[model samples]
Target: MKEAENIFLNLINQHKGIIHKISKMYMKDAEEQRDLFQEIVLQLWKAYPTFKGNSKFTTWMYRVCLNTALIYFKKDNRKVDKAPLDENIDIMDVNENEGKEEKLAYLYTAVQELNAIEKALIFLFLENQSHRDIAENLGISEVNARVKLNRTKEKLQFIIKKNGYEF
Candidate 1:
């Protein structure tokens, strides 16, 4: 139990940002985001024993966090009810220096328009995982992953244009 706790702590410390990122992507409200983050951590702890360490820890963390967030979002079905633009929405002025927070906010808003699966694809893509890795992680064919990614990108582009925002 001690060993498992240690490993979980290390993993959480290293990949906590991924949890924050996914939660922000899926949940607009602060309370919801906090709830989702706690849920992800709990799920990760529950599944910790089964982790085989075959893949990078961050990759594994991403899979777990994404799955948890997606499942939670599906169960609640509250995305449609949430405000399209909330005070938490962070818009970046591209004219000035772009920081991580600004990029993350823009990315989150763009991803909010995507379907669940598309959002997962875009998340992995942004993580710089190879198509093969994404396919394996997502349990889809490499060809399908590539196809979906391209389509998602196009959709995002269309969305940005429709919103009158330049990427």
Candidate 2:
């Protein structure tokens, strides 16, 4: 138990940023973000032993984090309504010179509009996973991964345009 706890703690310390990033991307409110973070941690701990180290730890961690967030969103049926257009048009203002927060917000809005499979695809794409790796991780064909990624990018572009953003 002590050994397992140590391993889990180490894994958490190493991969915690993924949890934070996913939570921030998916959850709008502070309370929901905290809940999602905790849930990701719990799910990671639960799935630890099955981790065979066949992939990089961070790669495996991304899979687990994405899976947990996707499942949580599904199970809770928590739908995020797109904010009314005039209510806060400036919220989507993205500055290329700025840091990740602004860019991430735009990406998050685009991501939120995607369906679950597309969300997973975009998540892996943004993480810089190759089509082959994404296919292995997602259990799909490499051709399918490539095709879906292209379509997902187009969908994201459409979402950005619909939201009045030029990106």
Candidate 3:
């Protein structure tokens, strides 16, 4: 039991960045992001016993994290107020320069307009996952994954451009 606990902790610590990115990609607000992050960790802990070593830890983790994100919507207290555009936006990378930061900020902002599955596709694609890997993670055919990804990219571009920034 002790060895299992230690192994789990070490694995989670090593991959904590992936969890943070998933939480951030799914939740826009800082507080909500934190809540979702905890929820994901809890879910992972609950499901950890089922991880048979058939796949890489990250491949398994991606399925769990993305599923949690898809189902982790707020518990019914919908917000009617919107934050102003000038409010601080969290970039995926902290070390990027101002120019790239601004671009990434806008990109993240545009990403919020995407549907949950679309967001997952874009997130995985950005992670450089192959089409087959994405298909496996998404539980879809490889051709379907490619088609959906291409369409999602077009839609994301349209959303970004509609928000007045050139692609």
Candidate 4:
């Protein structure tokens, strides 16, 4: 048991960023993100024992984390006010001048406007997953994945423009 615990801790420490990224994409509020992160960690630990070595650990982790995020529901459905958008912000051009943090913040804000499946597509795309891998992960046909991804990108660009930021 101690050996298993140490192994889990080591694996988690190495791959914890996956959890953080999923939580960030799925949640807007800091407190909610933290809670979701914890829930994902717990789910990962529970599912760890059943994991086989057939797939890469990170791939398996993505499946678990994404599943958790997809099904997670907030207790309250109340909407929170979003911060006012800056009229001059351009996501595509701004990233070149901004620091990584600012670029990431801008990306996340843009992503928050996406629906759940679109969010999943963008998350996988941002990670540079191949269409095959994304389709496998998402359980869709590769052609469908390609089509959806193209459309999702266009939609995201449209959303950014609608929000006064040009991509």
lDDT of candidate model 4 versus the reference? 0.77
Candidate 3's residue-wise lDDT over 19-105, tens digit each?
A: 887877777888988998999999998889999989999999999999888878534333322322221222234245767877777
- Give all TM-scores, in the order shown: 0.83, 0.80, 0.83, 0.84
Which tens-of-lDDT digit does each residue in 136-167 have in candidate 1?
87889999888777777777666666776665
Task: Give the range where candidate 1 is weakest over 10 consecutive residues by summed lDDT.
Answer: 81-90
lDDT of 2 by residue, 86-154 (tens): 211222334457666767777786777776667777767766789998887777999988887777777
Candidate 1 segments exceeding 4 Å error: 78-100
lDDT, each prediction = 0.76, 0.76, 0.79, 0.77
Model 1: lDDT of residue 3: 86
Worst 10 residues of 3 by lDDT: 82-91
Model 2, residue 25: distance off in Å is: 3.1
Q: How accurate is candidate 1 locally (lDDT)?
A: 0.76
Candidate 1 residue pairs in clash (backbone atoms < 3 Å):
none
> In model 2, where is the ten-residue run with the lowest total lDDT?
83-92
Query: Model 1 misses residue 16 by how many Å?
Result: 0.7
